[model samples]
Target: MRAFHVTFEPFSGGCGCGRRGAAVRGADGRTDALRLRAAATAHVACQVTKPNGSTHTRMGIKKLIIFLLVLSLCLEGGSAKEKGTKKGKKKGKQVYCPSQLSSEDLARVPANSTSNILNRLLISYDPRIRPNFKGIPVEDRVNIFINSFGSIQETTMDYRVNIFLRQRWNDPRLKLPQDFKSDSLTVDPKMFKCLWKPDLFFANEKSANFHDVTQENILLFIFRNGDVLISMRLSITLSCPLDLTLFPMDTQRCKMQLESFGYTTDDLQFMWQTGDPVQMDAIALPQFDIRQEDIDYGNCTKYYEGTGYYTCVEVIFTLRRQVGFYMMGVYAPTLLIVVLSWLSFWINPDASAARVPLV
Candidate 1:
């Protein structure tokens, strides 16, 4: 399809009466090379580059090839744009953070309500208040320093104990977004600003380990169900009334009572986690042997003081002095002395050394 000027008198060998003009046509017999090249270059910008960095077009044949490539490109571009729009719309939907709470669950919210608070409160005793001790430590601080003089065996007999108190309740206000497991928030006492806490107090508290601030704390557990559990660790000292009639051979049942400090029975109430009023901790005292004797909960009336009645949970600690130390220190020595005293019969009670021991 190269461009060539048509020559006149081209049919000399033929029997032509007059000179005929030869018309140059492309292989397609439709368009000339120059016109085809112009159309291809105008419609398709792609060029066939040679090693010499020059562009070459293959006359009429290249025009159809470039046109088909350009048409495919245009169709693909439209399809890609349509697909992108649909994907963007699909991704635009919002995901929820907090799962919503039901209305029935919301009505059961315990904050600021007149309902009684229930908790699992269990007690344990740490017996190692001092070196080589065998009895229950009195005050964790005080019993370590107590001294024994004469037959009194003057050691404190109170319980130095840790109380594990746990309360689990739902406050719908503590809910978090369903999408968030709550990196966004936390639950603390302040979060339950409107919730009423049972005014629990130790009736016979002689000393407290944490006196300045409350030994209480609250933690938010889950946002979905609005579940929260409040846990408190309390170190308490109670002066147990001692009856030393049995001396070292006795088991004592001392009591620790928990009652609402100022709340009347109408204003506030407390209940056990289970149907039973008392729950025992599995851990036992290290030195002294203690078992739960009795647990009773009832209204302690203060009719004389006009203070009405207060709800109380009372626990009785049944314990025996771990007698190994007592056996060695008191019983063994007394037994040896009694056995040696028979030597006085061998000698004369009238002798001076014998008289001194006898006296």
Candidate 2:
């Protein structure tokens, strides 16, 4: 028998001839190539299909993962944006409206302790009573400039206020009794008196704008008899210094300082009725004596008076305005007599002689 052809062919799924082959044994102990080739072809086809399928699956999974990551980032960003918008609205609301303090709240503040030094108090005429004069006349308004100097001494603060008055005048309403009049009016300085109400008393921190200072309540009063007085009641809250004993020990110095404030009203014009119309008169300053006192410094229940603590300065200043007289002598009558004599000299001599003879 012809030797059983035993041949094995190297499988090339592509059609080709002269391909290298390998020998295989048949089931009947003979070489069989067909079955072997068929099996190899099937294995190659399965391997190719498996790899392609696995590649497609992996790419799909990757795309799904990237999409999920992008969506999660977008959600987080949107949440942060919403939170920021809420915060902005809250700040905007607070900017337009602010809380206010009630009148009862202001009443809770304590009064200054310096209210009692001089017992004789002179108050200004109530503005309500003088409704016509509710606003100060521009000519009568006094411009005062006050400068304060202070030093810290043992247990007290030594402070002084320098005062200067400009264009000072007495109220035109002051009148003298008929019995007090003299041929030459001798206006005594001691007979006049005055009092000034400081502007600090009516300050309300809540209603007042933080930067405003023009809303101060201040007044000046004068007596017919030359005496000047000042009354100031101020309530102030302060933070105590670290060293309390460095305050000044002398109370008199403090009083002097409080009285040192001065004013400028020189340009002020005084008005008087001249028979028919108002006329402007130059106002003269009065000479007066000044006395100062610091009555109470709040409550001594906690500490000694004039200590380095939050307290007020109640000051009383007694002052006087002096008045002098202007003498109008017989000059006007003398001039008239001289004028008549000159006219008589100019008269015709004959006419004058005839008139004299008839008399």
Candidate 3:
């Protein structure tokens, strides 16, 4: 069977004078077309009563549907763009900030400033390797400050000392900006773990400890000329043999020594600071008075059985024993006892019991 689709236009006048209705023709062409057209035209007339506002209402409905469709398309486009941005962020690497500064300090730095100089120097840096890999020796200047001196024991032949050790060296790889204004820069102590350091140890120390009461007692300073400094506090028990042949009036000599544990003289060398290498606070001990101290910076290349020659440095301390303690506690009491015994002889020929007790 064949079927026809028809469309009708609204009537112009009350009698439906001027209008066009669509129709399809079949084997019974004229009859079928006339029936479909009449049916559609009658249906349109019943739906709209007044001809004056009918056209305007139909146009308004069409505009509303178009506006809703456009709004929905725009919303979908925005959602797709947001998803693409999030995926790009997940695929890219995050930037690294300097660990030496806290977040609050980093906020104070200007975006374009050279305050974060470490970022440029440490891009490809390796902390496990030494600075100079071209077979050149790195010269380090060493200094010390004796905060206290005590625990001098004669029986155990050892003494305890607390000190601050500072070492300075230069690495050409750490370049500074041309417009840098500061003479030196101070960084966080934790940065010490991220940089290369010389392997140094005390030669004559029996035991040692690094200070860490509230936090790690360490310091780092960088100069404009590529020099780096590291300072730390340490307590050490060192061998200090004493001579007691002179007993109460004896003077004792002690020394502290430092040497490289891994690097030999060919790769590293240590020298004392030129003018004033050693400094100390006012120190006092119970049994001895400090006479003098000596700092030796001469070359100390010594050969080991397995390893090559290593570098070393030494500091010597001279202490004189205080004799007044012995006099008051030992000599004075003995003299009084002998004089009292002599008096007992003069008074006790008849008092045998009292003389025996005194003797």
Candidate 4:
């Protein structure tokens, strides 16, 4: 069945009808606004869903960053603690000065090490002051040679060795003098001791009574700490008793035997009164000056038998300290004299009367 359609005709500018139309238009506009509002609501729901998804990811990243920060702090704290602990512990290595070494400590060094110490401590021998046996006069040449040879060859004589302790009272705080005198160091016998071996006699074919006058076969030791020790052995051949003979003749028999035969000890002892000791610094043998005189037996005998030999052995052990002084006393003056002579040549010959005289 077809329903009857109601159709409204437009009235001409009438108030009631126009107002109804206006209201209808207004209603349509309101419907459009509602649709727009629905669309905006849907967009807002999609935006909220996306933001929720991203919120979890952002929160997880923040937690990871915080954890890393805490872990770094813990590791840093542990490293700092380890460093502090290390610094608190003591180190194992140590250093020592020469003065720090006590007597006991010095004793621990081997003999070879002690020798090295002495080599470093002592001064070397001077070449200029070396004894010139050849320069001796012709008259004294034979005696000098005999004395030298006897000193080197003889094994025994008045064998005496001494060890002296030298100590100076200078202020340690003050600088040492330019010309420091070693003699200024006092000799303290109580600080050192010595050992000696005596000479013995025997008979030989060349000599009626032979005796050793010098301890040539002896070995002397001077430690770096100034201790001295000596070892000596002697032998001689003599038909007669050496004790009965006169001064020079008695020494000849001893000299011949000492030059010919001897035995020596390999080791020696050096002790100190200070009770504390170090190694030997230097060693030197004593020197001897010997003189000989020919004696005539009253009988007219042409042979050497009737012509007895008189020999004298003068042993002088100018201690090592004294030897150094002797060298200095001789060489220092000579060097000064040479320097003065050279300077004199540089002086103007016309400058002064002294210059002319010197020239």
Give the winner by lDDT. 3
- Please give each candidate's TM-score: 0.44, 0.16, 0.65, 0.16
RMSD of every candidate to native, in Å, equals 28.9, 37.7, 26.0, 39.9
- Residues 172-277, candidate 3, lDDT per residue (tens digit)? 6665666667777787776677778888888889999999878789988878777889999999999998888998998787888788999988888888888768
lDDT of 1 by residue, 38-134 (tens): 4444333323332345555577447757675675666567668878999998855542111233445545756443220110000111211221134
Whole-model Cα lDDT of every candidate shown, in order: 0.47, 0.31, 0.73, 0.31
By TM-score rank, best first, the candidates go 3, 1, 2, 4
Model 1 poorest 10 in a row by lDDT:
140-149
| Over 4 Å off, model 4 | 1-200, 203-322, 356-359
Clash count, predicted structure 1: 7
User: What is the number of backbone collisions in each predicted candidate, taken in the order shown?
Assistant: 7, 54, 0, 21
Worst 10 residues of 3 by lDDT: 15-24
State how far residue 21 of model 2 sits from its true place (Å).
99
Residue 75, candidate 1: how far off, in angstroms? 86
Can you give the lDDT of residue 321 in candidate 1?
61
**Better candidate number, 1 or 4, judged by TM-score:** 1
Model 2 Cα lDDT, one tens digit per residue, 187-248: 22222223222222211111212211342322333343422222222222211122323222
